[model samples]
Structure formats: structure tokens, C-alpha cells
Target: MNDFKQELIRYPAARITEVAKALSGDLRVRILETLGDMPMGVSQLAEALGVAQPTMTINIQILEQAGLVVSSPGANREKICYVTCKSILLELPVKTGDGLHRIEQIHMPIGMYSRSIVRPTCGMAGHDGVLIGSIDDPRAFYMPERTDASLLWFSGAGCLEYLFANPIPPGVPLDELRLTAELCSEAPSFDMNRQSDISLYMNDMPVGTWRSPGDFGDRKGKLTPDRWFSGTEYGALTEWKVTKDGGYVNGIRATGTTLGDLSLDYSEPIRVRLEVGKEAEFQGGLNLLGSGFGDHPQDIVMSFVRSIDRQ
Candidate 1:
């Protein structure tokens, strides 16, 4: 039990549609059911299920790419398949829209940060109530098990980036993009005097930087676990929105970067990074709080807004 692991795979609703396709066929489901017990070679699986090996291989490939299963070569070099995670969670929006709905939202876990360069006082906590690794160790931040983190915090200069999968269908131009999160300044245990300038970036382009008032320790966060005490607890639920007008944080104009400035209609995923660099004016560091450790109930939420007023 000393070795930590994550057995949950979460997907956005839009992307879930793609994954749902893999599970649509009965043959694929059967293959999955069989793989759940143990890993098997493609030929062995097909024979046991009384299906053609060629047909089985096709279905298995789809699940392998969706991260539902892992396939490898065996002694005879035949492909072996094994289910990856114990469970899969698909996050669906509360509402669906085709005409009136102009926004698409996706939540990215704090631990799923694709890139980072954190310094001392940095650490992460999994939902299980155990710290992933020793604090202040940048190497620990790269642990594969960090995906289970409910909260990721750090002191000093560093940046955490997430490659957000755009939900805006191809060929559709976006008029606005908004990112919302719960964050506060990092203090030794807890200090109201600490202030930090947190910057937001999209695909290496600077969106804006806002000054956090102080490290929050006012009271225990509603979702904070018993293991955490006297540390930064909660944060202001702020929204950084970039629209055709400009970039606005909490309804206050923070950056003039317009919607057109980002050219987000690309094939690659959207890159969003939150940073508090070493050279920052107020380098109080950052406490990027996620659900179960913050006042908020969710992690980083991104929404794509398409305005019909213009299009």
C-alpha cells in the first residue's frame, strides 16, 4: 500500500462522446468484460469469446487508444490487452445546447498539470488524505500518481500548465473563453499579510496577472480534510474571462488581450498555465486549491463561449 496509484480516468462530456463510441458495440463490451479479469492475447480472447481474431483486434485497438485498456506484446509477440483503470467518469454539463447554448465547459483536475517548474514548500495531496511525496521536491510533482491530487500547492516561483481539450467543434469560431479557479496566496502555515501576483497564460500568450489579497486561513474550508490544519485553506472564486471586448478578471479589466488575439481554432489542445514566477513583485507563492480542500467544489473550469450577437 506504500506505492500510491490512480485507478480513475475522467473525460469531458464532449470527449466522452468519442469514448462512448468505443463502448457502443457489444463486441467491444465483451472484450472489455473479459479483459477486466486478466490480460489476454488477442487470439486467446477471440477464441474464448468465439469471435474472429481480426474483429476482436479492431475493437481492442479502439479501447487501447482511448486509455480504457493497455495492450502489449507477449512471448509469441501476440498483442495482449488489459483494462487500465477501475472506473471511468465522464463529466457532463448540466445543460445541453445546440442553438441557444453558446458555451461549452470542461473541468481540468489540478493534478493533471502537463507542465510545471515548482520550488520549495511544494507538495500535493491525493483524495486518500496522504501526501503524494515529500514536500519541496520538484521531482515528486512529476509522479504519475499525482493525477489523484485533490490539491496542489507550492511556495516560491513556478508555473503549472494544463492542456485543456477544446470543446468548440472544429470550424466554429469562438467569441469568448473563460477560466475559473479557486486559489490563494501561500503562507508558512497561514498568514493574511502574504500577497502574490498570479499570472494566467494561454498557449504561451499572457492573458493577465491578478494580485491575490492574502493567504486565506479565515476558517476551515467547507471541503478541507481533517489532515490539513493551519495552512492556506480557501480562496476567492475568481473568473478570468477573455472575450471580444477584452480580458476581464472578476468583472474588472485585467488585460486588453482580445478574443482575436488567441487564435484558438487549432487542432492542438488549448494550453492554460497559472504562474507565480521568482521575479514576481509579490512572490508570496500560490496555493492552487482543488475540491475537498478549498471553499470551491470544483477545480479549474474552462468554458468556451460563442456569441451569436456577432456570428
Candidate 2:
């Protein structure tokens, strides 16, 4: 096994062709499976798989290039190969050309929150994985460097609000509004069992609440920098959506709030707020991970779907 022991990896669309091509060969597939069982030298792998050294070397090169396997120099200059991920996840967009709807998406960085109300155990970090300003200091959220934050966390109760420019074309009827983020409970160091109730608001209207299972730190996040060692490695990807009917979180009904309740207008900005209310049963706080620090290489994403037929 590798030193990092990375368990899950999510690839971006840019690498789909390379990864798919690398796995196209049966020999390369077998090599990865074998390495998953145990790291081995090239010669040993060749012998076990009934392949010659030259063939093994070529196959290993492909896997290495695809980032499916990692090889390090061993004694006698022999190369030791190890599988990099136990599980791989990729999100593919599905496009249906029926022309019934148009979808617009925008990525909002975690640090770009326009307003915040936080307390102790609150801080932000940039892509460098270094903490900005001081830890547990609310003032840190106001630092100019905040716009560069790739990750942020807080304990107790507070709210972070962001304003997203409306992307729907004027006079178009909205169908569904969706927001997604990588999130989890916050704890000092780390605790997998801690729970937190996180709430979402759109245009100052309560949307719903999500009770996160825990703060995950069992393994290092796929995108978390090697330099980051202050705990809280990754988070669960959560999506909240609002439609004409009601609000939903991952397909489950979360609130009676509806799209009409938000009174969205294409000319106005959308105010999205995430908070941990003081009255919440679980005041576990929250950790919001960005593209540079989570298993998913994305920040807060919002999607606006417009009804093509409705004027």
C-alpha cells in the first residue's frame, strides 16, 4: 500500500479519456487488480500474470500515466507498483436533446461568502493549505485573503451567506433551482460520529435542514494538500434543490418551501445562506470543503433550470 493510503478518488471530466483508454486493455486491468491485492515489483507481477517483463513495463507505464497506479524505485533499481485508489468516482453529465429545458450552472468559491457571523473554532485556509490570519478568530473571515480560501470551518452557531448573480435569461420561467456543496460536521482534530444540523436559505427564506452524519477524517481527502495536517480531511457531497412543488435534499422532502416562495427574478441576485442555528438539536458546527481540499474537485455549485416552453 502507498504511504497516503488514499481510498477513494473522483476524477474530473478532463481525465475521462485517458483513464478509460488506460483501462481498455485486459493486461492493464489485471495489473491494477493484482497491485490492489499487494504492491509488487514489475518482474514479480509479470511472472504472476504470465506476461513478459517488457509487456509488464509497458502496461505499468500506461497505468502510471493515467494515475491509476504509482511506481517507486526499489532495491536494485527495480520498480515497485501500487494501486493508487481503492474506489474511483466520476460524475458524468447527461444531456438529452429533447429541448424541453435549459440548465445554467455557476461555481461559487467557499471563501467568497459576502457576509458571515462566526465565533471560536472558525478560520479559513487557501489552496496552499495554510491557515489565513489566526485560528478560532472571527476577524479572520474579514481578511482580504478570505477570497482565496479553499476551506473554512466553524463551531457552535453562525451563518455564511453568498450572493450569486442570476443567470436565467429575462422573461424565462424557472423550473428548478439546485445548490450543491461538499460539507460535513466540524470537530477539533476529528470525530467521525459527530452530527450537525445545517440549514439552507434562499432569498432569506428557509429552505430546509440537513443533519450531517459526522466529521470525516478516516483517510486523507483525495484533493487535500499533503501540507495540510490540521485534521478534517474531506466531506460528503450534499445537494439541496427547490422546485415549484417544494424543497428537497438528495430527493428527500426537506421543507414545504417552493421556488415561488423565493420570488426569484433574473435581474436580481440570489442570496444563498448556510447556517447552524443556536436552537438546532445538533450544534456540531460545519466544515465546508472547496475544490482544492475535498474528494470532489468542485466548490459550491448552483444550477438554474429554465422551462423552455414557459414565457
* Per-prediction backbone clash count: 0, 0
In angstroms, the error of model 1 at 281 is 1.2
- lDDT of candidate 1? 0.80
Tens-place lDDT per residue, model 1, 233-305, is 7887878888877888888888788877777765678889899977889988888878767788998999888
Q: Residue 143 CA error for candidate 2 (Å)?
A: 0.4
Per-residue lDDT of model 2, residues 199-236, tens digit only: 99999888889999998899999999999998899999
User: How do the predictions measure up, each by TM-score?
Assistant: 0.67, 0.68
Show model 1 residue runs off by greater than 4 Å: 1-100
Instruction: Give each model's whole-structure lDDT.
Output: 0.80, 0.88
| Native RMSD of candidate 2 (Å) | 11.5
